[model samples]
Target chain A: MTGWLGSLRERAARITPGTLLVRGAAFVFAAGALLVAFPGEILLWPGAAVALVACGAAPALAPRTRLTTMVLFLAVGGWIVATTTYAEPVTWARLATLACLLYLVHTTAALAAVVPYDTVVAPAVLVRWLARTAVVLALTVGFAVASVVGVRVVSGQAYLVAAVAGVLLVAALAGLLTLSRRS
Target chain B: MADGSLGGAGDEDGWVPTRAFGRAILVVGVLVLLAALTGRYDLVVLAAPFALGTALSLRRRPAALPAPELSTMDARIVEGDDFAVRVSVANPDPVALDLVLVRLWLPRWVRVRDADHPYAAPVAAGSVAEIDLSGTALRWGRHDVGPLSLHGVACDGLLVSLRVECEPLPIKAYPATDPFRADEAMPRAAGLVGQHHSRKPGEGGELAGVREFSPGDRLRRIDWRVTLRTRRVHVVSTLSDRDAEVVLLLDVLHEAGESGGTGGAASVLDTTVRAAAGIAEHYLHRGDRVAMLEYGFRARRLRPATGRRQYLTVLEWLLDAKPAGGADQPSTGAFGAHLLSANALVIVLTPLLDQRSAAMVAGLARSGRFVVAVDTLPPSLRPPTDGAWGPLADRVWRMSRENVIGLLREHGVPVVGWAGAGSLDHVLRDVTRLASAPKVGRR
Candidate 1:
């Protein structure tokens, strides 16, 4: 694991700015695809578009500008969640779209922090970053799909409690991973 | 000057969190935990990306951090010569390094030619990335090149490794030599064997005269035709070529004007060392014994020696010598009189900035020692002022300098500006002529 991670870090160093832009575009496209997949939240379209653009263009913007954009993006995300809370029942598609948007923000910010504004990123490195983020998103979507199927079969507060338990389980698994990394 | 080796292995082999990493953790932790408490499935989805990223980044640990190695082709060079330095950082683990920034510390004497000083480059995992640092050495001195700082980041800046520091490299640039040469013959010759023709008749290649053969004369010396015509045992007598000692007295008390090194303004000391080197090489090449004496705050000497090897030895001493006294305090006369050989031609190289050095030249002249003071001061130097008093002060300085030279002329010491080859020809010829003329002795 150490050797594998070391190699990946070494490869990351070789990434250029061009590759960064391409990967960032892909992340933004993935977010747009999520918006299209869950068209039930019409109000989220403009907010999602703005957040994606802000995050995608973060590298080119000044640090202060990016900071402001991030703050605004978080506010919009909170509003979207609040507005959709009472509109309809939470479905697997809505959950998947939310997951994709969250991952897109994380990936965009991470890439922006790594490379400067003017640097030309290597293609292979950007692809590697995208591939890793995609794997995580796919896994999260798979969990949501499984939960939705389980809720359909057994509808009640019991299933909701189970869903909460599942969230706790994933959180605990993440904590354990962090602890192992520290050691 | 920092040395090349930075810190121990223990300090360099670890992962450290950057500000970005910390921010990521904070944002992920707060948002996800809030969503879990409220039991909002949509909010939980919103927090999933950060948690996954944090978990994945921390789950796999990288091996030892990259180690940097800095090297250069040549440490010792002449002024105006450019040298190439190679900086290679080695990654032992398979993790690709996304970003690596290296900042090098260079002395003022060196200027980078082709690239920016603080370099940034990318390195693939488990490989070495080399960067070229090309620069020209501007001056002659001992300089240090580095103790470079390296910043490495992996996993798209999510993971930043500990900064690595390297050591400094030492470089020495030697002074350039002028084109001055010395005369083949001296006024007086003391060594038995040399290349210069002497007045005294003896066994040599050049014909001196045809005279009656004297006892102890070699049979080969007898000129048969002269003996037959004069009805006597005449032998071919040739003038013996003897080597003479040339002592270079360098006045290192004061150095005036700016020194720009190669292709630039020459300071008094710059021209002085170059002229000294040229004279030494000229005399040494002609099989004449050469010695050097530097008098400033302290005196240093290289005993009279002959051969090409001793030229390098003399140059080494010249390189190490510096004008000791500051401009405020005039240098005292500290001539190495004990190191002088009898009838040695004393060529004093000085800018004549102080009266003490001028008086020393006068004393050497009065003692009947053949002396020549080569003016090492550049004539094109301007006074350090832009106002009306600038030209006035410069004129006053020049007038005083001329008066000093006139005094040396009165004492029969010829003062000449260094003009490369044949710079000492006329003065040496005058010394030879004076040696033959009759002079009044002390009462």
Candidate 2:
């Protein structure tokens, strides 16, 4: 498992600086388009943009950039959950959710294209990209849905959902680690 | 020669902390102050110190480092053997460096097995650090060993270190050849001269035939006393002296084993080297003066001599020879000059990969010198294509070999296809038989 992780890190290092800039630009453009489409919705516009930029640009940057992007993505997700609990259905919220979904697909494709495959291929690379995209998508949808239902789920339920998601993701990673070791 | 200068003639000595830890503390303190002032608490807490540490780790100043000088300890090394390369780093600064990182880049053919120091260490001022590196010679030829890079840092991670560029060193790896075994028997030509005694009679020295004395015959060769016993006037005919010179021509243009085989130990070049070594050693043992010429990137010659030492020298030369690139092919005039007066039995060991080499060999054979070509091509490395270009190229090569053989045969030269496996003796015998036959007219 450590070997797989190390290989993944090496592949990340090999990505050229130019490729990172181009992918980042594309993600920023998509985020800008999302913000323009959903004008007044405070939660939808900024949150979707941040999530999209993070997902697209994470693979291209150095270790520092990847960590920063992930942190920004988590912060934006937390803000969306906090803000949407008291708000009613807005067209902009629905549009923002749709925009986030589309951005996720675009970012995944962009990241996959730049991943260096010359050396050893590891499962962690695919798993990490998929897990990140899935988590962001799930959070965006859950918060948007909570906003729509007109029933404010307690902060305790939100924490419970987050805990379960974290455990499942860990289990999946552990399973992958064990499978890789056996092979 | 100024005060406060780093390494000039006139400077006062002072205790300066060159530790990386001290530098890191300074950077952390700056970051704490910046965080306190900016109120960007999250970024100041998360990024500042890590950023500082990374910058410190990769920091290098151009002027503060010592330049490294590289010299070849041993230029030529034999394949499968260990050899040393030395590099000297001189520190001109008055203040000592805490840690120094020396990174040496090696060529593709050379593999580093061991070194004196594998990691960074401290070096004092006005001192030189001489590093001795040892590695196995993985391939033959002239290889560049290093442009040794030096990275020095203080013990405290506050400031960026030093970076210096060093000169490159050349290492030549020679080919390895063993002594020839006497048990291996090769066919001996009749009436051939110098040291080996032959049973057949010839025109000088040994009495070969008894015939009636001709009018112009030397009186000393006449049997004058035979007249007294009613014998006819007779004369003694002696065998003529014949000295055969053997020239071993090695084809070093290209090596054969690029294509991976299912399972095999030796490549085509290995087989060729062994065969050439065997033949050259055999000739040298027989009191025959033997010379060697290598045809690769450039042509090299070792003049013919008969002795154990001469044979060893030739073997050593062969081991170190490398294949030259296609651009290095000699001019027509140079090729002509090299082969013009070569009267010895020229034994060419080659894989016959290109047309230029084949043409040159054919040209030499056509010039009436005794030529024997030992083709080193294995069947496995041939391209597996059925198209016109592929088949045509293969056929062209095959035809070139055949044409060379035919040309040599027309000039009474021998051509042997030594595939380096199975029965080499049989191949030699067959080639010898063909060589001995009357010359065939060229088509």
Best by lDDT: 1
True contact recovery of candidate 2: 0.00
- DockQ class, candidate 2: incorrect
| Candidate 2 accuracy as TM-score | 0.49
Query: What does candidate 1's lDDT look like per residue over B1-443, in tens digits?
Result: 11111233223456555444545555555555555565444455555555666666656546677889888888777767888888898878777676566777788777765333345567877899888778888877667888777767665455666668988777777667677665546888887788888877865677888888878999988899988888989988899878889999988888789888788888888888878888888889888899988877667778889998888788777777677775533234445454577679999998888898898889888877888899988988766867888888888988999999999998999999888888889888888777657888898
Chain B structural similarity as TM-score, candidate 1: 0.84
Worst 10 residues of 2 chain A by lDDT: A112-121
Write the residue-wise lDDT of candidate 1 on A29-125 in tens digits.
Answer: 4445334333345436668655545544443342212452354245435445444653556667866766675556555555555444334444555
Residue-level lDDT tens digits of model 2 in A61-141 = 421123323333343343333335534333435434543533342343233232222212123333444554455455545
True contacts kept of each: 0.23, 0.00
Q: What DockQ does every candidate get? A: 0.18, 0.02
The local distance difference test score of model 1 is 0.69
- TM-score for the A-chain in each candidate structure: 0.59, 0.35
Return the top candidate by DockQ: 1
